[model samples]
Each structure stands twice: as C-alpha cells, then as structure tokens.
Target: MSAGETVHLTLDEVRALAKAGLAKTGLSPDHVDAVAETMVSGERDGCASHGIYRLLVAASSVKSGVVVPDAVPELSEPSPALVRVDGKGGFAQLPFRLGAPLLAEKARKFGIAAMGLNNVVHFAALWPEVEELTRQGLVALAVTPSHAWVAPAGGTKPVFGTNPIAFGWPRSSGEPFIFDFATSAVARGEIELHRRAGKPVPDDWGYNADGHATTVAEEVLSGAMRTFGGHKGSALAAMVELLGGPLIGDMTSLQSIEADGGRGGSPIGGEFIIAIDPAGFVGDLLAEYMKHAEVMFETITGQGARLPSQRRYEARKKSLVQGVEIPAALMRDIEKLLEES
Candidate 1:
C-alpha cells in the first residue's frame, strides 16, 4: 500500500473503536482501555499486523468464551527476584501491566528480576514492554512462545513456534535501544500480511506442506516457516521454547489442541521477562554502554548493515510528526466493523 494513500486515526478514535469492540464482548471500560492502549501503541510503532488488525480476533475470542476478560492473573512470588503469574486465559495485556511494575520494583531492589507468565492470549508487540522498562532505567529482555510455525532443522513438519525475543536497554540519550525479533526467517505476521495482500512469500522464507521450499505465501501459511539461519535459528527457536514455553510448566506448540476444535484454548504459550538495574552492576554504565553500542552500530552501518530496531524507531518518529499510516483497505475494514457495531 502507498504511504500517501493511508489514513490517520487519532489515538482517541482508536481507543473508541477498541472500546466499542470490547463492549460488544461485555468487557468493562477499564479492560477496554487497557486493550486499546496496547493496540494503539502497536499501531503508533508501525507494527500493523499486531495492531488494529488483531483487535477483531481478540474481541472474537473473548465473545466466544475462548478468553476470559474478567480472568485475574494468579500471582506467585516464588523468590525475591522472581514472580510467576498464571494469566488464567485472560488478555495478554493484563499480565504485562501487572508484571512490568512489579519487575521494575524488584529490579530496583535487587540487581535483576524475572517474571514468567502463562495462559494469556497473544501479546501483540514486545516493544511496549521494553519501552516501559527502559523508562524505569532498567534493561529488559523478553521471550515468548507461539504456535508451531517453524520447522526444525532437517525436518519438514512445523514443529516450533516463531518464538520471538526482545531486548531493551536505556540510553543516555533518553531513547531506549530496543531490539525485538522472531527466531524464524520472517515474522509469522509478515507471512500473514503477504497472504492478505495476495502476494508470494520469498522462496528462502518458508517451506510447503510437502517440505519443499517455495515462494508462495499460501503454501507457507498452510505449511512451515523456515528458521532464520537454518540450524542456528532452529536451535534458537528450541531454546526459546524451552525458556518461554515449558520451563515454567506451561504448554508448548504441540500441546495446543483447542484451536483445532474451534474453541479458544489457552494458546498454551509462555513469556519470560527479565529486568535488570544497570546501576547495580556499574554506576553510570548507561553512558559507557551507549558508547560501545554506538561504535558497534556505526561499524555495522558502514558495512551495509542496518540496526534491528532502527526501522521501527524511525517509523514511530515519522508517525508522531506526520500521523500514523493505516492502509486504506485496513481502514475500510475497520470502518465497516465500526459501522456494524
């Protein structure tokens, strides 16, 4: 879609849409606001696949009794530096809101704090959580498991999740240096985007149901997404699934059978967040860290490498200056849904 053809929705308008959608599911204003804020943040950051497009899915899951809006996270303080929260099949944003502050508090006291969350719905974007921790002068690392979308090394079957991992570090320049990415060759969302656009996937990105590599998006959707770097990516995906899926006694990709039955089962995924207080390790280390990071980043740029988070960061700046861009088709769909509501 051409950027010039995009529509700009104000934050208020986005919130209103989310509120109306959530209300249709019998959610209270407070929960609606929470979901809306997360959705708008994703949109503002230019993650369109995880932004407004997923709102319909979320609302539908709630209305279908797949997700419980009133479900409270069961919090457990297993250690001074760790917390485990069972999301009780509620919206993902709830555990994020509850865990972030607690982790920040614990990080302030200890050198680091880690939290494990389970049984939540999809967490749209990882940047917002990292942004929150960065604002608290802490570095945050987050990892989450997903449905089987990627194949293991030398294997044809879809056996692993996209399993994204994200990291955020505070900078002396006031803007956090954040990196968030999927272990797969491309995000599953990107594949979905191509499917929606009726485009083909890159041949290097995924394999067909018969385990042959192809550039057809439909084949990838019906088959398996490739890991980013072959065996290395497959290994990392496995590690992520271990840390972010079953390590905390949560379900894995193979364990998620509810979706097959047309019931909103817990996606049975897990997420882990670790917040670290830089000051605890080295006072004024933020400055030193930025210095090294800058040098490394400049070297990469000189070698024709772009930083991981630079694109989204630049997109966010432009959005703030010139309004966020929403595809005309998406806007039309959103408008139609709004009218229906």
Candidate 2:
C-alpha cells in the first residue's frame, strides 16, 4: 500500500497488533491485556492518537528501562470512602483495573468515593477509567498529568502537562455520557502525528522557545504548546494539576517531568478519580432525578446540538460492523515493532 493509503482492520486484528507489540517488549500478560484493550477501544471509537499507534510509544518505554514490565499494583484503603493503589512504576491500566471495583463499591456504600493511583506511568486517555466506573452505575470523574509539554496561558515556558480530565455519567439506557479532553489547545500526540506526516499545525496550537506563535510542528515539539481558551483554559489546567497531583500525594506535572530525567518515557505520577452514587443521595427518588437528567439531555440534542462523545459513539457503532481504517504508514510502524521482537 502507498504510505498515505488506508488499511482496514477489524477490532480483533487491532487487539492482536497491540498485544503482539507489547508482549515483545517483555510486559506481563495481564499488563499486555489491559493495555491492548485500551488501544483497541481507542481505535474502535476512532481515536487514532491513542490507538494502535501507541504500540510504538509503549515499546520505546520498555526500552527506556523506566517502566517495570511486570509490576503488580498494590491496593489499600485508608478510609471507608477512599481507595489507593500504588502502581510500582508500571503502566496505569492494570492499577486502575485492580482498583475500579473497590472504588465503585465504596461509592455505592457511602454515596461518594475517591481513588488515588500513585507512581503509575500514564500514557492513555482518562476516559477508560471513568467509563468503567459509570458501567457500575455511578458518576465518575478522573484526571491525570503528563510530561510537561504545554505552557501555561500567556507564558513562554512549559509548566503544565496536557493535563486531561474525563467525566462519565450513567444513564438508565444506552451509552453513558462521557467526555475526555486536554486543557491544552490540542493533545500533544496530535502535534506529534503532524510532525510524522510532514505537516504544519494551526497558528494557535503552539509557540516557539521565545513565545512566538508558529505553525511548525518541530518547533512546538521542542518549545511549548498553548492552552485552549487562553486564561480560562489555564485555570482549568491548574485545577487538573492540583486535583491529580498534590491532592493525591503524588508528583505534579513539573515534578513528574523532572523525575523522568530525560528518558522520554511515560509520565510517572498520580491520577485522582471520584465516583458518586445517585442512589445514596436520592434514596427512593432515583427515577425522579434521572428523569430530570434525561430532560436536560433531550433539550440539548433536541436543538440539534451534539452532546459530548456523540460522534465517538456513532463511530463506535459503525466500526463494530464495518471495522476501522488506519493509515498504511502507521500500520507499518506497528508491524516494525513486532518484527524487532
């Protein structure tokens, strides 16, 4: 296939590609499974940045020696409504998988609960964690920091990570209402993809080392990224930094990047997740409150306004039946990692 051509792959094929690539890196079977599932879901739902493309990044992390391929997460409960897990320097997926059940249970018992995951190397989006809690019939919010890449609003230096926040709300029927977005103008991965494709970025997405805005992807990669919505986005990014960092007794984005020591692996830090159970608050009037939420959703969609994650859900349905398409060039990159094994 031509470099720019697309290749269609079923979800199973996507899983196999992820698993094979990760397994060759000496990651344990369980970690491989968890990571592969996250990648497959990203591809199935049309998130190319987080999909099979991540295999190359994961493989590089293994080579960096910063990640423990077989590290097992350890869990503890310091309070009735709080759960904590230490990832032991492993990827975040397995830790979240191990702690999610207890988190949901605590939320159901106490009306609300919080989970803190520390020392985990984060790479994927936060949506998977919150979405898992929503499947257990709770409202969930999750946030995490990454390596410092984006600059604070109106600043020239890099301080904040992409600092994504994800939220999930359970509904009586159909898919949960979910949103996951970076506080920055765009995800760092998107810029990296542009660089790989030999393309320049939008004028506002990144700035050079001297704080001058530029369209060159390489400059942004070396310099800093701009936050979305100017100062408003900066404030939200600060909230994410505090919530996912000091509040959890873990490293902030700056600290996380410093700890990396320029190894260029995933960010080592904490993620804070909160889950709320409506039944605990409404008791017998759960249906009444749910009706109110449905009306809100209806009002928004009725006006032809698309809800958050609507396009993703629609893409998911189509991919399930028709499979998904990825760039031929990215396919070759994934194949190369497996070949190197």
Candidate 3:
C-alpha cells in the first residue's frame, strides 16, 4: 500500500459503515448516528487519524464496558457563569454537544461562560466543538487532558497526556480560524500510526525505555512520549491537567488505570471550554478582528510563514472539491473490517 494512495467513499457510505459496525456491537441507533457524524466530519476535515481510524478502539471500549453507551451527564451549577458536567463515563461528545450550546447561550447573555466536563472518553479533535461555538458567533477555547502519554520535562516516565488545547474565532470567510494542537512533541495518534505501519518515529519525538531519545515508535510507546518544547510544553501540559483534570474532579491518566483493567484505563479525559461573545466585549469585533488578522496573516505569509489551520483547511477544500484521499493501508483496513462485519 502506498502512503498517498486515495480511496473515495461518499459521506453516506462512510456513515453507513460506521453505523453498521457499531450496531453489530449492540449500540443504539442514536449513539451510532452521533458517533458516525463526528467520525465523518473528522475525515472530511482531513483529520483521518482521529476519524474512522479510531472506530475500532471506540467500539471496543463500549463493548468492553469501559464506556457507558447510555450514560447520562450530571450537571452542577457552581456559579452563574460556570457549569460543571460529570459525564458519568459516557462518550465525550455527549457532554460536548450538550454543554457547548448551553455555554454559547450563557455567553450571549453574560458576555462569557465556561464549562468543565469530566468522566468522558477522548473527544476526538477539538475543532468540532469550537466550530459549533463559532457558528453561533462566539469565540471558543477548549482544552482537554487525555490518557498519559507524554513525559514531563527532564523526566523519563510518562506523567501527562498529550493535552490538546484548541481555540476558535469566527471568520466571515469559508471557515473559522481554528487552532488545535497537542502539547506533546507529537500526537499519540501519530505515534500509534507509526507503530501500526511498523515505522520508526522521529528522534526528537520520544525517548527509549532507558530515558534516552530514540526514533523507535515501539520503544517510545513502551516508554515515554516527549514533551513538545522541554519545560515550556511540560508547563503548558501541567496547566491543562490542572484545569482540565482535578478541577473538574475527573480521573487523571493515573487514576484511570484503576478503572480500565490496567491497560491505561478507559480514557476518562477531562475538558474545559470557554465561550466569549465578541459583541459583548466590543462592537463589531468580528470585523475588526478579521481585518487585523488578515493584515498580520499576510505579513507572516509574506515572510515565509503559514497560518495555523491553513494546511488542514487547504486539504479539506481539495478533498471536498475532488475526493477524500484515504491512505491505501487505511482503505484496506476499512475493507477488512467491513468483511469481518
């Protein structure tokens, strides 16, 4: 299978396959629909690593009783502008869908609102949630701590998750200015991809079991993934853990081990989202913000820099105009899974 080979599947075909796969495991149609929608959106947005590639893990987690398919979110109002939700071990998207709109409405009224979500599985990418808030004409910031995969600076052992943080601002153009990234040297999904492909990681991406830097994905997976920028990344990751972790009273990576039968637990990740109404802060802020952003963006591009989301946005546009280019290996895996189903 070549690395860049493309496979074309219509949106309906992809969703149908995901729904059928989930249904075979006794998942409800509603759950299947929601999950399938998220997965398809990820693929359409050119985030295939977090798309159907994760279906097997998600379904297995549900079937193994690690994730409660029908779990309900427990809401608590600690303050007028702050809401906390205990996911009760459900899929992460459940609380995201529920809380995002609530926060948006609250922000519209209060100028700003924040929600803390805990006890949910990994929420895929942060773009989807942020896009929703942007569509509502609000700026949104979402941060989450996942299963511990990256090591702290100067530490050999893994002590923190990849710790993704995302921010989104409304733009008048084709897409919102969305930025999502992991604090780790590389994303866990990328490492997993390398492992699945039997390829080595980059030397700077991780360390060996002996605490020495290495390019071997298996070694890093068995040992510790590196922090992105030494202490800076570690500090950011620590902040994410505190804000997205115990503040909401959810299980950290270490705490999750007790629940997931010791294979790193069920990814009881924690998340925090802040929504801000631009108009509340300043009149016609979107127009002004976009104007300034364009100037700065042009300056940077002129100096040989690209905006944060430009690559993904370009890939998405091309995919929509042409077709999604799924790698050959991923296509083969999808076919194999369909055959098994």
Candidate 4:
C-alpha cells in the first residue's frame, strides 16, 4: 500500500502488530505485552498518536540501547502514603503495574496516596494510568515530563517539556470522567506526524531555533515548541516538570534530554500518580455524593456540554465493533521493523 493509503485493522490485529513489532525491538516478552496493550487501547479509543504509531519512538529507545530490554522493575514503600518503583531503564508500564496495587492499598488505608515511577522511559498516554485507578473506584491524577522541546511563555529557550497531565474521576456507572492533555500547543507526535506527512503546522505551534514563529514542523522540532494558553500552559508544564521530576527524585526535562545523548527517543525520567478514595471522605454518604456527581454531569450534558472523555468512549464502543484504521505508511514501517529485526 502507498503512504497515503490507509489500512483497516481489527483490535486483535492492532495488538498483534504492536506485540510483534515491540518483540523485534528487543523489549522482553512481558514488557512487549504490557506496552502492546497500551497501543491496542490507544487505537481502540481513537488516539492515533498513542496507538501503533508509538512503536517508532519506543523502538528508537530500545535500538539505541537507552532502554534495558530485560530490566526488572523493583518496588518499595517509601512511606505510608507513598510508593516508589525503580524501572531500572525499562519502559514505565511494568513499574506502574508493580506499584498500582500498593498505591490502591495505601490510598484505601490512608485516604490518599502517591506513586513515583523512576528511571523509566515514558511513552504511553497518562489516561490509562489514571483510568486504571478510577476503575477501582478511586480518583486519580498522573503527570510526566517529556524531553525539553517546548519553550515557556514568551521565551525562546526550550526549557520545558511537552508535559502532559491526566485526571480521572469515577462515576456511579459506565465510564469514568477523564481528561488528558499536553501543556504544549500540540503533542510532539502531532508535530512529527505533520512533518512526516509533508504538511505545515499552525503558526502558533512553534518557533524556529532563533525563536521566530514558523509553520514548519521540522524547524519547530529542532527549535522550540509553544505551550498552550501561553503563560497559563507554561505554568502547568513547569508544575508537571517539577512534580514528575524533582518531586519524584528524577530528572527534569532538560536533564532528561541531556541524558538522551542526542538519541531521538522517548524521555527517561519519572511519573507522579496520585490516588484518592472518595469513600474515605464521604463514608456511608458515598452513594449520595455519587448521585450528586451524576447530577452535575447531567446538568453539563443537559446543556450540550460534553465531558472530555466522551469522544474516546464513543470511539471505543465503535472500535469494539468495527475495528480501527491506520495509515498504510505506518503499517509498512512497522512491518519493515519487524522484518529487519
């Protein structure tokens, strides 16, 4: 198929493609499964940026020897309200898996808890992290820093990562309420996608190395990406950098990129995840409060205001029945990676 053509794939096909490609990249069997599941979920939820396309970036880290293929994630309880995991140079998924249960337990016992995942290569979307906690009837928040590619407000220097934050609130029934977004004007992958498609990005997306506004994606990549909402977004990005980096005893965006040694791979650093139990706060009134929450949601939807995760949930339903479609160019690329490796 040509680069412009598209390939339709079932959820199973997406999983198979992700697993096969990741396996060829020297990620261990378990890690491949963990990461592939993320890709499948991304595709199933219509997040093209986080789907099978993510293999290119993940493989870059593995191929460069930045990610230790066989690293084992080790977990420890740092405090009654905090858990920590050392990823030992592997992907973030396994570390999170190892720590999630402990996080939930601590949250249940202490009302709130935090988990720090360190020395991990972060690639997947944060919603999955928070969504998992919400599934256990807990509110969750997650944040992580990417490489130092974005500039703070009104500044030319690339001092901030395209830091993303996600929050999840459990509902009485069906899907939870969730929102995940990058502080950058657009995700780095979005810019990369524009570059690969030979398309110009929006003027506000980035600036040249000299900091002049430009519509060219490649220049923005080598130069400075803009943050959304100017100062407000910059501040949030800084918060993510701080909370996910120094707060967790890991590298900041600048430090993360420096550690990259010029490898165009995923960031190597930490993630901050918080879980809070509503039961702890409301007690037996949990049911009443949950109904109250539903009223708020209904009021919003009743006025035609959509919840942030509505589109994703809708796509998920459709994909479960109809599957997903991927660009043929990306498909061929993955196929080649699997073949050559």
Candidate 5:
C-alpha cells in the first residue's frame, strides 16, 4: 500500500488475520477464535476503539503475563438461579461463553438468573454477550470493570474504570434493542487511539493531573477520564464498579491495578451479567408487552428518533458489502506482528 493509503478487508480476512496473530501469541485455538470474532465484530460494527486496533495491546498483555492466553474458564453454580465462572486469568469472552447458557437455562426456568465472572480480563465491547442472550429470548444486562481511568465527580485523580454497561431487550422479531456505553465521558480506548495518532480529545472528555480539563489526549490519559454527566455518570460508574468487582468477588479497577503491580494493560477484574426470561413471568402477556413497546417505539421514531442499535446495524450492513477498513499504519503494525510471530 502507498503511504497514507487505507486497506479494506473482507470480514473473513479480518477474522483470519486476528485469529492467526492471536494464536501466534500462544492463545488456545478456541480462545483465539473467540477473541478474533469479538475484535472483528467491533470493526464490522464501526466500533473502532474495540476493533482490530486492540490486537497489538492484547498481544502485549499476553506477553506481559497480564492475560493467560491458554487459560480455561471454570463454571460453578452457587444457587439454582445463579451461575458463576472463574476465568483463570483469561479473556472475559470465554467465561461468558462458559456461563451464559447455564444462566439462560436457569432464567427460563426461574424467571431470572445472574452470571458472575471473576478473574477475567475484558478488552472488548459488552454488547455481544447480552445481544446473544437476547437471541435466546431473554433480556440481559452486562457490566464489566476496567482500569481506573475515570474520576468521581469533583475529584482530580481517577477512581473508576470507563465501566461500560450493556443492556439488551429481545424483540418479538428482527433485531433486539441493545445499547452499550462507557459511563466515562468517552471510552478510554478512544483517547488512547487519539494519543496513538497524535491527536487531541475534547476538553470535556478528561482532566489533567491538576484536575483541570484539557484536550491533549496524552495528558488526559496521563491523568483521568471524566464522567459523562458529572455526578450522575459517576454514580453509574460506581454502581458498575461495585457490581462487576466487589459484588462478584473481584477487585475494583484501582484494587486490581494495585494488586497487579501497577501494570498498564487491559484490566483484571470481573463481569456481572443478568438474564431475565420475560416469558416466565408474562407468558401470553408478552405479546401485549410487545404491542405497547412497539407503539412507543413507533411514536418515537415517527418524531425522527432512532433505536439504540440502529447505527451499529447500519454499519454492519455496509461492512458486509464494502469490507472493514484498517488504517495504513495500524495494518503495517499488524503485519510486523505477523512477521515477528
């Protein structure tokens, strides 16, 4: 490719590249495939922060011993409606995969179930797990802790992770309603991407060491990411931290970092996922529920509103035909890793 030229790759190509690179880092075949699909989905859905750009960092984490590429998740049940998984210091996806089906089964039988995942590292978007649950006719909510990079309201230093939360509500047909976001003003990875490309972030996105806001991506990263809505978002982040960490017998972002010798990589924490079966409670009422929900949806969209996952769905549709785009520099970096591997 010429200087500054971008590369477009089919979804299969992206997945193959990611799988090969991740496998070379010593991840087991299943683990490599899981991570590759997650990463490629990010690119296909236009979530650049969590997409192929993350592969290098993931590789680094494996090398740094922060992630056990070949580790397997262990599942256990503490109650009829509670499912738990220990990731054994591996990626979060495997644990979710190990536990989700059990949770779904219990939820179907008991109306609701919770899956607690500990000793895991989450470096990808949270929607995939919850969205998959929705496909099984369940509503789902998932939260995961990350590195402490967001400040509580009125604070200088960061005390919370970007702390993403994802929720999915299954529709009667077609795509489900799914939404995922970081409680921080912006995702931490977006800032890192800006820093990598030598760009500035918005002032509201973060603070410097002195607690003053700044646009310099590197400075923001050096200090703290900001809460999206002042105290409100901070509170949500705190909730996620407690749910994904302490409540799940894992460390909060700060605690994880302190325990891990202050290493900078994807966080070692936990995930909390809740699956609720609407049919168990409503049964035939579900159709009525859908009717009411669709009425509200149609009313909102009539006024030019849109559903939460619409953008992602549109992006996915386009990517199916046009392929995923990789920045020239990033492609070169991945190629170098492939060569090294």
Candidate 6:
C-alpha cells in the first residue's frame, strides 16, 4: 500500500473482520466477540493505539498461547465493599465485564467499593471500564501497569510502564466526564506505530541507550521512553505500579515479563478499579455541584479550551456517519486474516 492510502469502513466491518481474525486464532466465540467489540470501540473513539492496530497483536498472542482463548473470569467478594476477579490468564475485557457491575452495586449500597482483577492480559484502553461505572451512576477510577518501558525521572533505566490511568464522573445529564492518559511522554503503542511507519518522534519522547534524547523511533524503541512530566509523571507511574500491581497481589512492571518468561506479548498485569456513589455522601448536593461544573465547563469551552474526552466524543459521532479510515496495508492484513479464517 502506498503512503496515505486508506480504506473507509464502518464499525460493523471492523468488528466482523476482527471477530473472524480472532476466531481463526482459536479465541472462543464469546471471547472473540468481546475483544472485537472493545477494539471497535477504541476505533470509534479515535484511539488508534488501541484500535485495529492491536488486532493482529492480539491474534498473535492467542496463537502463541500468550493469551488463553477460552479462559473464564472468576469473581469473589471476600468483603462487602471489596471485589476480587481472577481473569484466568485471559483478556481483561471478560473479567472487567463481570466485575464492574458488581463493584457499582456494592458502591451503591456501601457508598464506595474497589475491585482488583488479577492474572489478566490487558491490551486495550482503560477508559471503557471507568466509563461503564459512570453510566451506572457512579464515579470511577481505573489503573493498570505494564511491562517496563518508561524511565523514571532523571534516570535512563526503564523502571515503569507507560502505565495508563482513567477516571470518570457521572453527570446529571449527558455523557460522563472522562479522562484517560498515559504516564509516559507518549503511549507505547503510539511510539510503536511511528516506528512501523518509519517516522521520527519528538526529541523529548524517549532516550537512547546512552541516555540521550532522540527523535528516531527505532532508537527510542530500543532504549527507554521518558515520563510525561519528568519527576511528576514518574511519581504517578509509581503510584499506578503500587495500586495496580503489588496492591492487587499481582506482578509489577518488571515482574510481568519475568512471570511470563519473556514471551514478548501484550503486558500481563492487573487492573484496579474503584467506584463511588454520589448518593452516599450528599445526594441533592451532588446535583447542585454538577450544575456548577456545567457552568464552569461552558465557561471553559467559551474560552476555547476543550474538555477531556471531547475529541473522543466528537470522533465517535463522525465515525458513526462517515466511517473509520484504516490504512490500506492494515486493511489488507485484516483481509488476509479473514481469508485464512
């Protein structure tokens, strides 16, 4: 495929192609549907890092036994407000799907609840989990760590993952306010995409082996990715490591690869989610607070500052009508997988 050549396709097309490819890789029918839906959601929301670009990687992982295809999530609530989900070494979506509603229910009863999903392979974006809780009328926070790729502040050695975190707050009306971000200067998948396209990244994105910042994507991939805000981002990354890793009795960034004997697939990790019901604290006051927030949001937009998740919401609307555009090369790859299936 030539540069800039793309194929415009609807969400259904993307999902059908992903389902066929994943099914061919031996993922169970239900698992295939779950993963495909999550992937299509990413594409719909303009998250290229977690969209169709990840389908082939997921298929490869399943084929190589890195991700167990038919694994089922196990949920156990040892405490009234605490939930533990075992992903059975499978994809994260299945475990999260089973545990999130339970967490929300617990939060509604007890004011707050937390869930930890362990022994899972999380390859997609984290916003979906928190957004689901918000849709259930709860505020939510979700965090997950990954294999080490990001360097700590002032250090060349990579000690942290590009650990992404997401938060959502339910509104009285309209969609929830949501934000998802990577602690690193850029998401690891974005860097990988640039490398694949033979493009140079920003000089501040990552450092070479000698600890010198470089724009060459290949060098950054071979070396260490930098934290977004130097020490501050490094600190947040550490917080995620503790919350999503050891806090959940799961492996930390460095331990992920070790646990898997360096098989080199998606990050094998844990997911930590917290849900809070506004009615628990101040029911009527919460509605008033949202009104104030809406006024502030209007003011912010009036000043031309975009709210978090605005781009994603707009992208979803556009994608629904105009369809998503996938690179010709990527479409060809998906088509090949479909043909094989």
TM-score per candidate: 0.88, 0.94, 0.89, 0.95, 0.94, 0.94
State in Å the error of residue 259, model 5. Answer: 2.8
Residue clash pairs of candidate 5: none
Alpha-carbon deviation at 255 in model 1, angstroms = 1.3
Runs of candidate 6 with Cα error greater than 4 angstroms are 1-3, 197-200
Residue-level lDDT for 248 in candidate 4: 91
Model with the higher lDDT, candidate 2 or 3: 2
| Top-scoring candidate (lDDT) | 4
Q: What is the lDDT of residue 10 in candidate 6?
A: 94
Worst window of 10 by summed lDDT in candidate 4: 1-10
Candidate 5 lDDT, tens digit per residue, 1-341? 12367888999999999998898788898889788989988999987767887889789999999999888899999888999999999998888887888999999989999999999987888998888899998999999878888899988698998898999998886688999988998877688778988888888888898889999999999899888988999999999999999887989989876767867767898999999998877798889887887888779879999988988989999998999878888998999988893
Deviation in Å, model 5, residue 257 alpha carbon: 2.0
Show where candidate 5 strays beyond 4 Å. 1-4, 193-200
Off by over 4 Å in 3: 1-6, 264-266, 284-286, 302-304, 325-341
Model 6 — TM-score against the truth?
Answer: 0.94
Local accuracy of candidate 2 as per-residue lDDT tens digits, 217-326: 98998899989999999988888899889998899899998999988878999999999997987899999999899999999999999989898899899999999999
Residue range 285-325, candidate 1, lDDT tens digits: 65776688778767987998876777777777876666665
lDDT of 3 by residue, 206-235 (tens): 888899998888899878998888899999
Q: Residue 155 lDDT in model 2? A: 90
- Regions more than 4 Å wrong, model 4: 1-4
Please give, for residues 1-341, the per-residue lDDT of candidate 4 as tens digits.
Answer: 22467999999999998998998888899899889999998999998888998998888878888899888999998787999999999999989988999999999999999999999998889998899999998999999998999999979779889899999999968899999999999888789889988899999998999889999999999999999998999999999999999999999999999999897778899999999999998899999999998999999999999999999999999999999989988988998898893
With a 3 Å backbone cut-off (N, CA, C), the pairs that clash in candidate 1 are: none
Q: Which TM-score value belongs to model 3?
A: 0.89
Q: Ten-residue segment with the worst summed lDDT in candidate 6?
A: 257-266
Q: After superposition, how far is residue 146 of candidate 1 from its true place, in Å?
A: 0.5
Q: Which stretches of candidate 2 lie over 4 Å from their true place?
A: 1-3, 197-199
